[model samples]
Target: MQKPVIRPRRLRQSVAMRNQVRELNVHPNELVLPVFVREGISEAQEISSLPGIYQHTLDSIRGVVNEAAKAGVGGIMLFGVPAERDAVGSGATDPDGILNRALRVVAEEAGDAITVQADLCLDEFTDHGHCGVLDSRGRVDNDATLERYTEMAVVQAESGAQIIGMSGMMDGQIAAARDALDDAGHDDAVLLAYSAKYASAFYGPFREAVDSQLQGDRRTYQMDPANRREGILEARLDIEEGADIVMVKPAMSYLDVLADVSAESQVPVWAYQVSGEYAMIQAAALNGWIDRERAIAESIVSIRRAGADAVLTYFATEYAQALRAF
Candidate 1:
């Protein structure tokens, strides 16, 4: 046989060799854990749709924060489940609102050990379950929503959130939030914009986690998955509006969008491996259809390979612990 000129498989000859040549590494500090704290729950409640995740009570939040900190995870993204919901999502801006209160508790527990981020959106607090206020025609009032977001941003900052995750996808939201933060003397706080969040079916498990009362889809505000160029455009607008970090939601299904946003963005790019993605892996693993740990590792690695500077995932703690062992 003729001698071959190149052998690409040489690098794959052994685990040691593969490890040495690995171009992408998923580290504990690059993983962010997403947590939910319910308003009136006296005890921790499991989110059945999202296995191994809980709707923690205020008292229980400390335990969750301690566990995440112990895992050496990069950050914690907190979501609140209010006991009551209403028009304009009044609870969102209230200093004692579930989300705000949870932020305070978590910040106290975490201190400066890990980044504490709040989901600065109205959907969880709104009885209508829409991300913002509605006009007389029942359509999302974009400008009105921006005003609410500005207020929510300040409250979250005052509550000790190091980062505010602007996930409503409202127009002018970034500028409004930045201005509000500066005016309120929270200029030190960072804004993480969900610049390319899509109205996705993948949000199903999340709805269950938050007990979302959404009557219809959010297609009017969120991006359409069919459009890739728009993702880059959204990220550009956020960057121009003083967003410290820009993110693409439902990361796995939108890796193409994530990659595009990452390539063109000047700031750090993050991706959220949302609830459905997490549920699917858990379900498959339970059925013995996939190696749970390997799948988890590969899923996050794919997101990293697609250019995410960090990943927000339900499996963050487990993945971080595994990386620690390695």
Candidate 2:
């Protein structure tokens, strides 16, 4: 009743004014596309839940990568699904392993036009579906897993991956991988740490994408969602341990953590709008409940507005193309 002194609505009166005053802008380079590549397949297999996305074989993966680059996507996050699973996930580090092979394939296709990142977790490798070796009690062996991650980081880096996404969520994974990369003379290779990755149901689709055989949950390693302070702590530890970038998984659901990490991080803070989030929007759109393109833009815009420097998303290529048109 104080004569509406502020009059903030005046700036919202026009589309041009709103556009000019927009604070967080999602750019093509700020988006990273997550791709799934599988072995022992000759063609792309469509994913039911994730429409328009496919599980690509090597021959087909190249084309997808080229499309991503042409659409102005900043990078690709590679996940591998092997034809077989083993007790130790032995295939993960083999030079010709599914993930490493896909890395090489994508790198060659992109050819310096895009950043190629490989997932450095062993869940897709081990038959047990744990990130590392298991103990007698069937619990994850964290130290042993760190060792495996170290080996994987180098294998992925040598395979032409520009960045290693250390997603194991092990206590010392970032430091271990950093040392392994530098000692192997891959000093230029960077680490994109999954700093605040939480054990969330959002990863259900990712398991299918990677053909993971995980027998149990990852509560022992991945962060608990109830602990907000731990998110910042994890990000800080990764940064101190030589991570080039730190990320918060399932971006929209963890905006608080993303904001905290972004405000505190000296390095780039990335967020992942993971599989479940994508599925939710897709389902709503399919049912005619929401506009797909507008919803996608809003979802990513919210992440950027929360202070994330970049976002990893399955919708990256689509959104990047849409952004250009906008």
Candidate 3:
């Protein structure tokens, strides 16, 4: 073989050399833990579809919050699984509703140690399993849904959620939420818009985690996965409407969208390594098809390399602890 004087492999020759030249790194504070808190439960219940994850009771959720804070995870996104549901998702805005109460509990438990985020959507509270109210024709009413979202924003802020994740994919949601929060004197609350959320099949495991009531899909509202350009458009619109941060969901499969949003956005861009992404890696690892720890690290690093300022994942606490160990 001819001698290659300009070999690039020099940098990869050692772990310390590679670390020094690494383009991206996943830190404990860049991971957000998504948690489920279920009403009418006294103990934490493991989610079967999402192995090693749980639907926690209020008391049990506090422990998770403390653990996340201690692990130096950036935040915890709280999803509520209510025991009761209604046509209009009345529980979502109630002061004592399961989500709001969990927010308060998490806020108290985490204090200033971690950002307290709440899922501002009706899917978990609605008996019909849609993100919005159905009109006379049984179609989701966009205008009516915005009204519910505004109410949700105010209540979530009141419950001590520092960040309100607007994930319903409703049109004009960010603007409505921003106005509602400001009017309610919650001007300091941050709005993290699920700006480019797609109607994807990867959300199957999440339905089990939240005990979702959805009968059909949300294709009418959520963007199509095939349309990549729409992701950038949606994210820009959200930014113009006062989104403090914009997100590209199902991170692994949508890195192009995440990169597009990160490039065009002036604000922070985030990606969600959704439940399906987590479940697949776990399943493969458990079956001895992959190196579990390496896969987790690679997945997170890939998301960050693609330009996510932060990532929300089920692996947040564990990954953060692992990172700290190094």
Candidate 4:
């Protein structure tokens, strides 16, 4: 019997040939870097779990953002590590809060060259790991959290954030934030809905970066990883509710969902390379198992190949610089 009609192996002969036949490629403009900036700190504090990642001080954040801008990254996704927490998560909506301060700085440095995106979730401000306030039964209150998101949207826009990243995994969050932004005359600012965020174990190191106060799981709010079709449903709901951009969290494990959503959605699709994914690569590199730079670029490129128009990753600056060197 004939083995094959065409020689597929020919494309694998050389680096140039492989690249020429590569169907998917990662671009510099598609990379969005996630940065952790603390409220009050003298120097950058490295997160042991996420190597090469740090919680920068306000002064340090300015320099970091400036450097990322020069690297030609698509944008900076900001997460503020507050020095304090409360039941209501007041720091999230406060104009003087760390997040707002960083947003202003990022916007100033970027100035339309890149989108300054702010994580609009309350988990970073809450005393509990839950993304929202607790009810009398100690469960996350979805409706109440929506109200908080509305208020937070206004604050973020006021703080000069070009985009609000709804990463709390809460329902109705996109609609509520959109209404609030429109009412506050920030209708132009984009709402990037974390539409298919899952309650995955891959978020372990992120807890350290933002100093999460989570005691239990986030199953009720975040999607269950067992469900794939449901991600498409959630993405649809978010688009109908006014999300300017829809995203799937932890890109590597859920690339199928991202691809499906990208095919159906009218707006742009994005994916997040969560902390766990970053830590795994860092650990392998530290132990001399893999080339860190190549792994970082390859991982991000895989996500882009999976149908993400943009990606939120910790390696945005490094990857962008690498892409430009080509």
- Candidate 3, residues 276-300, lDDT tens digits: the string is 9999999999999999999999999
| Candidate 1: tens digits of C-alpha lDDT, residues 1-326 | 99888999999999999999999888899999999999877899998989999999999989878888898999999999999999899999999999999999999999888999999999998999999999999999999999999999999999999999999999989999999999999999999999999989999999999999999899999999899999999999999999999999989999999999999999999999999999999999999999999999999999999999999999999999999999
Comparing 2 and 3 on lDDT, the stronger one: 3
By summed lDDT, which 10 consecutive residues of candidate 2 come out lowest?
A: 1-10
User: How would the candidate models be sorted by lDDT, starting from the highest?
Assistant: 3, 1, 4, 2
Decoy 3 TM-score against native: 0.99
Candidate 4 has an lDDT of 0.90
Taken over the whole model, the C-alpha lDDT of each candidate is 0.94, 0.89, 0.95, 0.90
How much is the lDDT of residue 309 in candidate 2?
Answer: 89
* Candidate with the larger TM-score of 1 and 4: 1
* Residue 118's lDDT in candidate 4: 92
Clashing pairs in 1: none
Q: In model 3, what lDDT does residue 94 have?
A: 96
Q: Which residue pairs come into collision in candidate 3?
A: none
TM-score, cand. 1: 0.99
**What lDDT score goes with residue 167 in model 4?**
87
TM-score of each: 0.99, 0.97, 0.99, 0.96
Off by over 4 Å in 4: 1-5
Give the per-residue lDDT digits (tens) of candidate 4, residues 1-326: 87887988988999999989888888778888899999878899999899889999877887877778788888888999899999989999889999998888878877878888899888999988678989999999999999998999999999988888998888888888888889889999999999999999999999989999889789988999989999999999999999999999989999999999999999999999999999999899989999999899888888988899998888888888888888
* Native-to-model Cα distance after best TM-score fit, residue 39 in candidate 2, in Å: 0.8
Judged by lDDT against the true structure, how good is candidate 2?
0.89
Clashes of each: 0, 2, 0, 2
